[model samples]
Target: MTNSPAGHTPNVVLITGTSSGIGLHAAIAAAQAGHTVVATMRNLEGTRALLDAADAAGVTLDIRRLDVTEAQSVTEVVAGIVGRYGRLDAVVNNAGSGHLGTIENETIDQVRAVMEVNFFGVVGVTRAALPHLRTSHGRLITVTSVGGVIGQPFNEAYCAAKFAVEGFMESLAPVVRSAGVSVTVVEPGAVATSFVANVGFDPTAPAAVGDPYAAGLAAYLARAGSSFASAQTAESAGSVVAALLDGDVPPFRVQTSDAARQFVGVKLADLDGSAVQRLTSGWIA
Candidate 1:
């Protein structure tokens, strides 16, 4: 956090996907913490929720529209922020779409849809902001998922996109260290957000006639539903993300809760696939 050449904290911060959930809360938290937060979302029409939340939180944000999937949009937004503040100190890669389906049951385009927003979208934004971050010796934080470390059933596309982010960022951290841009990926387990509902999984809808994955899907959904029922709150998770912006340079990887830490720890310590396989298989059993 104090690694910045500008000061002990990031002066100007930009976050994507502020339309709702983690992005919305993180923007507010950062602003409340005294950072000039630029809250950006893919759609301008969806600003009411965030605007109202900011009003309630007693913090003001420089709101803007930014679609991470578009290269020109990303470049212009980053440029605009730097133009306004003269430098960008931090970026939170929080814009992503959720998908719920296995590869065979889904088309290639569907999988690519997830990747476009979840993975490539991140790459585009990070690329556009790095030069400025390099200038400020700032921070790069991405909100990945526990699924990123251990794949989950019926989340082939979503897990793949998250896994890609994990790999991309892990490789990028060291290379950017000399430039002084600290990188960290925040992994949150089941945060209570519209993200899950938007995944488009109709648990009540019977699987296609005689679908081979019918039973497994049912089991997975039951487990997922229960997990979501006890999911971490978005405000709780966002606070963690914002707090990372200040401490003694956060670790390259972090979990939002003790449960998330334990979930991800399984993969980190597993020499073979057995431990993860055992745990996840039980979810669909």
Candidate 2:
């Protein structure tokens, strides 16, 4: 589908996991930018608060239920949007979870849980939405983490999942370019979201490690919490999304927070050596 000027706006946008955090903010920000918004979540009822916030801001959103892990649900939601909107301008794969754990101490299920929601879920949603996006030559954006590029201590599973997301999106970008579809992955540093507070901690919550490691865990938790507290807000992330959407050409990777940008530079600089061993040496056995 060729781009049409609907009141001078470029396209309609559909975002997943819009109940809170960057997903919620991005939906509202895009709507404010005059793009039609489809703000979807696992449960529409859980997004009543978001609906109220949008109402207060006088921005309208087409809220729907979208469980990205379920193929049927993804297909239904994308079909509904395309049927109603005639074209899709962009789709943001923003639904994901965080995990903090040592690999040995963490259960297989714990790691699988993160992958299901963060990697496979995104793959399902993006695949389902590709047809509509192809029709419009739209953009596919995913909100990944800095861990995706650089692994961190005690975040083995989370880092793995983000790495998978980055790889998947990166590989998909070239294939879709011929269809005029663009893919951009946003790598954010710790952000002030309920995610950290709700992060699954190695299947044992805060009490996962026994005695000596438990003390280290506590210290790590303190630093992690502080880092997230001092990190960028959801509004700032939304602004970054808005900027990417408005850009003439989409970037393959967009780092939002200053911390993420710095970390990216450090990570890129270490590409030639044993960076993985250097970063994970102290933590991993």
Candidate 3:
């Protein structure tokens, strides 16, 4: 997809992890909306289905290779896009994975792996894309989970990574605002995708799982899987983020799903003045 011929077409958007789920849907939606879409994955071979969707929609798309973890991959992908397209108008950082286990039992390597993909990978992609984004005065949209804001029993590693991303994006937004780039974090609730199927869990490696906590974690996973089975589809989340990509003065954070709204609202609101005052009374007083 080349830059808008007249610099006044819809816009150009780049989305990550388009092999399946929300990323796949968002790429198709953005293309359908008339944007020049560059969709990337670890390998484009898995995205033939996405290509078919684009074909049916009559939207031209460019799907490419991008491994978010490799600094060279990130740099090369961004450089290739800018060289071919001239500018990048928006980016959706949707590539991520899940880790399930108690923090204590998880190996340091396991924790680092989760953080690499979820947090630092995001940082790498954003850093590589920022120059082009600045050229287009574009927006950066990140997809995070409700786990980022609230604690989920078995997903301590996943939650920690997302929480760190939340803090990172929040802090980076102000620094980039004046450079004509904006940042938004998207919090999605459970959705029925292949996410659970690919979740990383090491059964043999052992730290701490007490019986009660183990029971709760088991129940939570079951409930979550069932809820995902019954919840909205990935397409719903894709549409929301795609729409935000073109909307005016988009919010710094936009949350999707009733479940996400409920969790984020309660958790963030729970950190209000009264609570803070009481908790920090020793220092304040």
Candidate 4:
């Protein structure tokens, strides 16, 4: 969707991962757009940035605690919101993690940890809120990544989960729309955010004793660092996400920037997108 705002009624919006980055800005932007925002995070201990941003934006948000990976927490949060507001209008599944490891190096449990947060976390939240969304004719928006479209090295588990999210939402969109709930996924490319900081990957570190992938890891990290150095800001991407909430009909898919669009354009077509794929090939070369 374009960064154009549409006329919209105030909605009760539930957003996950509001402690920082896209989620923090998104919660604030949605509130600034006049939505009744419930900004939630896994732990309430880190509300500093979110609170500060809300204050700076001059918008009040209902702060709550929600862990998307926990079934009970997801269910209870959605139930509580409906009970408090008398209706539920929208949910933004923005809680996610960054993992930087290939399968052989990362244990099965580690991969499962990634899926639990990125994939099942989304499923849990969406499932819990679907009933209310159906009743309210509301929206379901997820913050997926460009990695969801174009798989990246060292992001196997992360990309797989995102790919599953994209596939699940794509398949559910039409069926859910028939029930009055709209589903949309916002895809972003490299963004200037704490996401990378949280990945725990140190290219400068000595590789584990005789790690076979050390050289490839270093090359990929160098290119990735450059991509992020020129990355779009979290606030810009957040605003694009916020704009979608007001439209009468949200696009089935939205890439938050030109880079994101060009990246995802690879899977959507066989033209210039192929050139983009070849560019990543050099990252591990």
Candidate 5:
């Protein structure tokens, strides 16, 4: 184990959703920073990219299968980690799913599916790790999106799930702090990843050929595409999570990039909700 600046022993970090995107990057970054990383995902079949990236970075990770949406999977993984490592110093809940559609267009089942992955998945992992975290004075970090703070057009279901996560963490932060565990929510703006393509919906696809919400959806997709063109890289965002895990006094909330900070700042600065309403209204108008 390595020693932190404060001389604390290196963390035994567990990060979920390591199959790709931010989770993959965070797992690599944490391992490079000297933490014992246990990177997990729902399936290990498509982990070649992650393995290749880690190899290029000269860091090795103990990869495991942990489906955060399943309570038994979460319990078994956490228990196994603790039994082997003797302590779990930190857990980064990076597993998430995305949905893109207005409330009028999406089925309730579709929204619930997003919640199952984004909200309940985080809850399962946190609950399973809580006892160990309390014992080790560990940290709980989650990779939320700017949508968590502001409702974006065509992202009703996705934002709702993220909003629920932010609320749950904000409320649980203080309670867990008393038990020596730090809770933090890291929000990122448009990240350049396969996330949009993997979300199981393509607004720009020809499938939306004659949908009622096509025009509005197309416009929103164009705007989002423009934003993603200049978005932060997954590796950059991952470094933020790594830094938080290494910090002795991490903040309760953080934005991975300046753009993210500015985006979230708008809603935070709106005391009357007028600014957000005006902006969101334009998206679907």
Candidate 6:
């Protein structure tokens, strides 16, 4: 097990998707806070960016290759961490892909693809690490989105997957609490990142010829552009995950920014689903 300068045992944090964005930032933040971080991504070649950032910040991470979509990869990485550290204290499920476009525009394959990464990917990782987590009485932090709480227009598939994640974690939280494991879902609103681009959506592109949903899509794009223009930084979002990992008792649900809180608050405050429908309808209208 790793030890801090003061000789206290340090937490061993496993963070997925450390190639960039929130994952990379969270790995650095955790390492800087004295936790031993095993930063994993689909491709080890992508570790250069994370390594450069960690070097600049004077933090070190044990980098590994892990593809959450692959069950073998998940099992191997988790086993390796436990073998080396003797315990796994926390897991940050940040390896996710976004899907844009309406339900009509997205094919069944595309929908399944998003679910594979955003929802089932979390399941794969959590299932693999839960044994070790239960042994250590550790934490499980998954980076969901505000869309998970209130589905946004043109984000049908992505939101559906996130909603599944939220429900799954919520249901598992109590069950795992008995085993001394905590489950927390970290929700973040729009952040300045390449997420949209990585999702293969071009907000500035001209609408597809003769598409019925073109107008609504354009409107959603405009609103997303404005939201991202004033979006929070990736580092800000990562800090939320880091904080939850370091906390003795983390809340079941947390929003990274106040804007995220406000966005998700609307849904939590509404007993009926009408308020969210009305708000979402306004975007298309």
* Candidate achieving the largest lDDT: 1
How would you encode candidate 2's per-residue C-alpha lDDT over 1-285 as one tens digit per residue? 122233445478889988988888888888887788899999777887788779977999999998888889998888888899777788888998877877677689988988999999999988888887777777888999889988887787889999999999999999998887888999988788777766844434556335446665666666666676688998788778766666575679999988889877777788574765565444433
- The candidate with the higher TM-score, 5 or 6, is 6
TM-score of every model versus the real structure: 0.98, 0.90, 0.88, 0.94, 0.94, 0.95
Task: Judging by lDDT, tell me the better candidate of 3 and 6.
Answer: 6
Best by TM-score: 1
Q: Which ten residues in a row have the lowest lDDT in candidate 6?
A: 1-10
What are the lDDT figures for the candidates, one per model? 0.92, 0.81, 0.81, 0.88, 0.88, 0.89
Model 3 clash pairs are 105-207
User: Candidate 1 lDDT, tens digit per residue, 1-285?
Assistant: 587774444389999999889888899999999999999999999999999999999999999989999999998999999898899999999999888998878899998989999999999999999999999889999999998999999999999999999999999999998888999999999999999999977788767987898899889988988999999999999999999888699999999998899999999999998999999999888
lDDT (10s digit) by residue, model 6, range 1-285: 211122446888999999999998999999988899999999898888898999999988999999999999999999999999988988999999988888777699999999999999999999999998888878889999998899888889999999999999999999998988889999999988777679878777777789999888877777778889999999989887888866457789999999999989899998988999998988877
Q: Model 2: how far is 198 from its true place, Å?
A: 1.6
Cα lDDT, model 3, residue 29: 90
Q: Indicate whether candidate 2 or candidate 5 has the larger TM-score.
A: 5
lDDT of 5 at 113: 90
By TM-score rank, best first, the candidates go 1, 6, 5, 4, 2, 3
Error of 2 at 95 (Å): 0.5
TM-score of 4: 0.94
* Model 6, total clashes: 0
Per-residue lDDT of model 4, residues 1-285, tens digit only: 111123435678899999999999998999998899999999999899998998888999999999988898998889999999877788899999999999888799999999999999999999999998887788899999998987888889999999999999999999998987888999999999999999867766788888898888888988888999999999999998888788566888999999999878777775556665686777888
- State the local distance difference test value for candidate 1: 0.92
Which of the predicted structures, 3 or 6, would earn the higher TM-score when compared with the native? Answer: 6
Q: What would you estimate as the lDDT of candidate 5?
A: 0.88
lDDT of 5 by residue, 88-158 (tens): 98999999977787777668998889999999999999999999988888889999999999998888889
